[model samples]
Target: MGARGQGRPVAVIGAGAVGTSVASALARAGRPVTVCGASRRIERIEVTEDGSTETWPVAQATVPDDITGYDTAVLAVKAHQTDAAAAWLKAVSAPGTTVLVAQNGVEQRERVAPHTDGAYVVPAVVYLNAERTAPGRATLRRVGRWDLVLPDEAPARALAAELSAGLMRVGLEADFATVAWAKLLGNITANPLTALTGRRVDVLRDPGIGTVARLITDEAVRVARAEGAALSAAHAREVLAWLENAPEGATTSMLQDRIAGRPLEYDALTGAVVRAAERHGIDVPVNRLILALTSAIHPGQ
Candidate 1:
């Protein structure tokens, strides 16, 4: 099936870097697409992946009512913006529709299910490193091979087929919990550390900071295993290594939010790990401290 999902319309919520990139991919695949809640009204979306650029014309809708008959909605808003984007969720979540949540953190279903009107929620582990350069422009800085990881379910498989276009490669994993938790492990450490220090990806190479990151990841690994995510100490080390080797001068979403003076997404990233640790009676001093400090810096959360 196409991105329209058997000829039904498809909509992308949020016009941030990730949203625009996905929209560009779908449009490039000859799928009928619409973008809702764009930061600005634009007729085109431009995404530069690696060193190549692709542009596609898209229908832009500012209000939920303007978009109807959408069978698939790719939600790309930040964790903190979920509540604010609830209206768009309701609009596209017609009965039996699928909402593909392309956000950070592992609690994508929990965070989004409440807002949808009984629509099927498919959580996606997004691996794309996209940055919005302007209103309708984004750059996909390649950090890994795949762009998304979803559960090995019918909805996910269908969604993956529709999204296999351009640079948007998708993977279906039988053990999605492990994949989600592993991705969270990287974000739980890298995002907060960079935001707090006002530094780029290379800051993780500092000895003292590296030690703190390891501690945070170690604690999170315990939480992940407790939550049945098959994580180990070796995985923690791998997370640190991946971040340390990321392109120099690369900024995390949390660091970008700090620079823009917007609310940080620590609650969903670090805060989620802390919450799970509490349930399992696990002591997560590093993660808890990082959560506290990052929470203080966020605007409203």
Candidate 2:
């Protein structure tokens, strides 16, 4: 079925960088899409990706109630802003709504499930490096395939098929928890460290920062394993290696939020690791320190 069986009505909430990129790509592909929520009244979108820039018209950005019809609502807001998306959820989501949560961390389903009752909550590991230059205008510096982890349901398979045929590549994963936590292990450390340092990910090239990253990730991986994610120390090291070798100026979402003076996602990323570790009787001292530092500095919390 297409967009909850209504056929081709896709609403992408939170017209930030990632949301704008996803909506622009879908609409440009003649997929009948809308870019909405907490954004200016955008008549069109300008996107730059893969050495090419394209502009596409879309339904003007609007509130949730303004969505006359929609089958798929992609929740692309920051994890901490689920409350905002909750209101939008009630506006556009129906019993058959498919809510694709494109956010950081492993708590996508938990964060969004309470709002969109009876909807298919699919957690996606987003791997795109798109930046919002202005409202309704975004630049995709790099693009990576989105991985959707969902139950082997017909709707999920159908949605996966639809998204895969866009400017964005998409794949389906059978073991979502493993994938989510593994992604989180990489996200949790880099975001907080980058936000704290106000620097790009390559700062991990420093031995001191790299050691802190490993120590924190080591504890986080233990908690992930306790929570049945099957993450290992080697996996944590691999994540660190990736960060160390990241492009010189590559920044994380948390770092961008800090730079832009927006509320940081402390609770969702690092805070989630700390809370999970507690449940497993594991210690995450480094993560705790990083969380406290970032929280103390983030004015909007």
Candidate 3:
């Protein structure tokens, strides 16, 4: 604990690529960190530039019971898995434990709020594209800072600094809603398109496929505005530009889930846009089609 004030251990709820990365970052910073989840597999991780490499053990525990005594918990599970993760947090952690959500989409904080006892729920919008290449190996596609959006209050800033210090680069944003919506704008396009077409992100950026990407992003931008998230058209344009410039070999998480035949976070990424469109009384025809296509591809999801 660097600059510590009540040093409760840090727990990462899911040891997937994102969870492992966060846990490794904290553990590298000399914090007491444990990763808890149902997966019993052990993983060997090598952290970036910090020379932190360790064999990470995944603790076995079921939902709503496994979450335990850590002062800070980072929920890095997929968006659809958030409810069960929240329930676990409620059963395990004491009140006032900070819960940081490191998932895609904008609804994780809201989803986790009902279960936890008014714990400081920090909604983080992740930017780095990390993937589980093997059981214990994950590769980082982007080396970017983690952006955490919380109130400017002392507690929030202090928590941000504590979580960020000596780990990955962390930035505090006053308008967190805007940051989340902007990240959502980026995620909404690549994920669904890649899942639906079974194409890698590079292939999806072709002129024909690029049009579909634009359509989905445009609809998400509209919904973000309707929800008062303060995103702009330029954000949507930038999303497209990023897609065009992204590594051709890169595959979205949705694509990975589809190939593995595991449940996808469709409900959060693309399905979220569809729900938001209905809420705003706006037409999201392209998004609806993408959702249908992706869902059809994953039948029974």
Candidate 4:
């Protein structure tokens, strides 16, 4: 179960874009990794840099009852899929298993805690812009690094160091809350706006769309402030400015889901904002409108 010395058996629960990318990086680092919860068609072509891949032929990928004897389990599934994935973790994971959550949003640890049996749940903020171009192939749009937020534990730091040594950059930050909220602010601007307008990130450069992007950023900043997360107006503006400079054809994941007719993460991203606004006793009409529009388009949730 343990990787003698520095090596560890890593099981990636989801073989989506993020999951495949992380599994590749871990394999490149000589960490024995296996990807589960994907179709055999994808599994056959799920080639890591080190040429290691496994096809988990299971109907419910979130169920971990079939997965066994892995040191670390990385949950790269969607936010809504976390509950089912956690149920599987509880069934299969051992006490010493380390669960690294590489999904977006700030509440992943909370969502997975109930299903884990005393496993260390480490929250991580991934910064790579990866997209699945094919069933098993993912294109790395931006080779950004990963920022990890770990509990005050030595084993967590050791794990971070090992993963950081891979291809992309990796860093551990003491103020994990700030790091997470910062990424959320960026996501708030790019995701919902693209989903609502059916435009790419560069659409923000248009003066009319730019104004809406600013509004979204402004509301997110207010909610973050109300949540006691230290995010400034300047930070929000910086996020908007970055979107303005992004590629003209850079569509967000939400937009991509819309094109593919899959369920979007509107509830997790924009819906989270509404919940946060309620907690702060602040009304975010702009984000509320965006959320409503996106939800209307999908109507799957």
Candidate 5:
């Protein structure tokens, strides 16, 4: 079915930067889209791309009970916020629905499967670099080739075809575990350090910080390989280079959460690496230290 074939609205959970951007893209492509969030009233979602901002008058539903229908849904909340978003997931997901988990970490399927009733949950690796400047507003800073990467499966292929008309592009990969782990390497390296230092992507330019980032990448690469992802030692350097080359002053989701005093998502990024390392009996001192420091910053969250 195409964008308008089934007459079913596409639900995007979480009004954060990623969610707003995805909703805006799909809406611009003429797909019926509903943005379900925590807002008490309908809000105009705006996304700025290539110096131009556009507002989408998509359907809005804030309450979980109000989100009772949708054939496809994107769960864009942070890993730590999964519990809070469970109600919406349950309301929109059923046997025929397709729920795409667009959050961080390598455990997207495991993290979101329980929340979605009988709907097929597709794990996605989001490659977009956008930030929620304010409520209902997000700016896309990078002009990347694809916004999401998914496995080469029937569900993922169908979702990719659905999004083909939008600004968001989806790539189907045969080895999705490797792709997810590669992205996770970027997260575990950039996120924890940036949140801890209260800096942006440029912080990796510092020699000391760069050293720590490499150490973190090395550990994560090892853990990712152990977890059946095809990552190499050279991939560590490539991940660091990618982070260092990001747009100047670009902020990560973890850094944004830190600035807002919200709970850090280190448990998903750094915590994922550490957990895998423990299971494989690998030594990852730097990753363990970063996880501890980030978790302490927002204790009990």
Candidate 6:
């Protein structure tokens, strides 16, 4: 709806909640959206919230051959699934293609760009509370907004305008690393803690759990600073408080993975901090413990 790109298509790869909602956003903007899932199990993408449902009848592409022309492909799969996107990336990504990497943590461009050559890859931090119930049905559990934060760049500006035309709010970030790491701090506690205890974000409100959660953020802040992320140690306390006040029924993607018997992204979220801390000679024992404990539960190896 922003600019009719001369017949160039926009594809959302992965049928997960984030990807589904993004496709819905584009569809609501009067864009003909293409959805490429792991399989062709879905015929419709339903986004529901507060007893209201918005359904999009999308063109389904389960394999590379089923996919058509596209200029932008939003990589909405988990970090671990980036490897799985290699085939699809090679098929749809042409010269001048822009792939939006929408996933948790940082280094998204590093993981996704290599699979497709001659494409401008962008990284975006997504804020959403949606979960897939059926193959095509995703429940927008929280009645909030969907948003994307991207570095201030030419392509990112275009993407922001395009998504903002629909049901999304876009923010431009001059210091993208800090914004990304700051969001990562918000994830470290809820992700690992919920996955371990099999509880929702409500666990963070407990006095004892809240203390440990804050400590994890504190350590992650040290790692973020060492990486020149421009995050404040004070923000660590804020992250803990924010989680404590979040919706009681909210759950992280990592927790969803554990509950669904899928692979957890501990390596990308908390484990990322530990790896960065080791490289910078910083001590992050709190992160190390949670990472170790999470790995014990989900050895994704």
Q: lDDT tens digits, residues 1-301, model 4?
A: 6453346557777767777677666766767665566655444324332234433221233335556766777788878788767655775466777877888787877778778777878887776666666665665555223434454466567667666665546677777777778788878778877777777777778898888878887888889888777889898887777667664355677777777777788777778878989987998999899888877885443
Instruction: Give the per-residue lDDT digits (tens) of candidate 1, residues 7-117.
Output: 455788877888887777677666666888776778888888668887887888888987666778889989889999998899877766889998999899999878997
Residues 113-173 of candidate 5: C-alpha lDDT, one tens digit per residue: 7888689998989888999988778998863467889889898887777666675788999
**Candidate 6 per-residue C-alpha lDDT over 1-301 given as tens digits, one digit per residue, 9 for 90 to 100:** 2333533467778879888877777777766777785565666789987779989777777777665456778888999888987888877677767888889997787787778787788898776777888776787654224367888999888877777777577788899999899889988888889889888888998888888988898888888998999888777876676677776577788888888888888888987898899999999998999988988885442
Residue 188 lDDT in candidate 1 = 89
lDDT of 2: 0.76
lDDT of 2 at 296: 90
Cα lDDT, all candidates: 0.84, 0.76, 0.69, 0.70, 0.84, 0.80
TM-score for each predicted model, relative to the true structure? 0.94, 0.91, 0.86, 0.86, 0.94, 0.93
Which runs in model 3 stand beyond 4 Å of their true positions? 1-7, 43-67, 143-155, 299-301
Clashing pairs in 2: none
Error of 1 at 33 (Å): 2.6
The segments of candidate 1 whose C-alpha lies over 4 angstroms from its true place after superposition are: 1-8, 298-301
User: Using lDDT as the measure, what is the rank order of every candidate, best first?
Assistant: 1, 5, 6, 2, 4, 3
Better of 3 and 6 by TM-score: 6
What is the Cα-based lDDT of residue 90 in candidate 5? 94
Candidate 2 Cα outliers beyond 4 Å, as residue runs: 1-7, 143-153
Backbone steric clashes in candidate 1, count: 0
For model 4, the local distance difference test gives 0.70
